[model samples]
Target: MEKNPAVAFNQPNHLPVCDWLNRAIDQGLNERTAPLARALMRVQEQLTWRYGYERMRPGLARKYAYAELLGSNGPVISENLILSVVLFAPKHIP
Candidate 1:
């Protein structure tokens, strides 16, 4: 990197970001997680609605690029983190 800064998006790497993402998603993630897909779709839809389509599109793309650059493509944690968070919510009684 220090010697070849152009290696970030260079010819040797045919799919730098895509390959990285594919490798990350390849591990442990079951592509058939329907409920999780629906939940993510809802979250994306809400963001699209609130931020407007054009703005959200570019912003989401930017986020993807940012995550790719940072190599933050780990296993999906929505089901684990989100479900756990919701489950532990304070129980109220009248």
Candidate 2:
């Protein structure tokens, strides 16, 4: 198993969730990882207003970190999941 190049998305912290997901999708598409890119696209649709990685089960989190995100080169789609959790998870908690 390999690790994805974890990215940070909180420099300014005002980016919309949809925009963030789109950027990541573009990165994945550019990297030619169509499957993962498509999967992420689905995630975007499935995602709720308060969604974040923290709400995911550990297994799901692992699923998101596919080979494409952790390629030998720097991650094509770079966004910090932790930052997402911090910002969005609270609203999602039930």
Question: Model 1, 1-94: lDDT tens per residue?
Answer: 1232221221112211232333333331566755544544343212211111344443243223221111112122122221110111112311
The TM-score of candidate 1 is 0.20
- Strongest candidate by lDDT: 2
Q: Which residue ranges in model 1 land beyond 4 Å of their true spot?
A: 1-30, 48-94
RMSD of each: 17.7, 13.7
- Deviating ranges (above 4 Å) for candidate 2: 1-15, 49-94
Candidate 1 colliding pairs:
none
Give the 10-residue window scoring lowest on summed lDDT in candidate 2. Answer: 82-91
- Cα displacement (angstroms), candidate 2, residue 57, comes to 23
RMSD of 2: 13.7
Tens-digit lDDT track of model 2 for 6-73: 44222221224333456567767878687767875664443333324457665333223212222222
TM-score of each: 0.20, 0.31
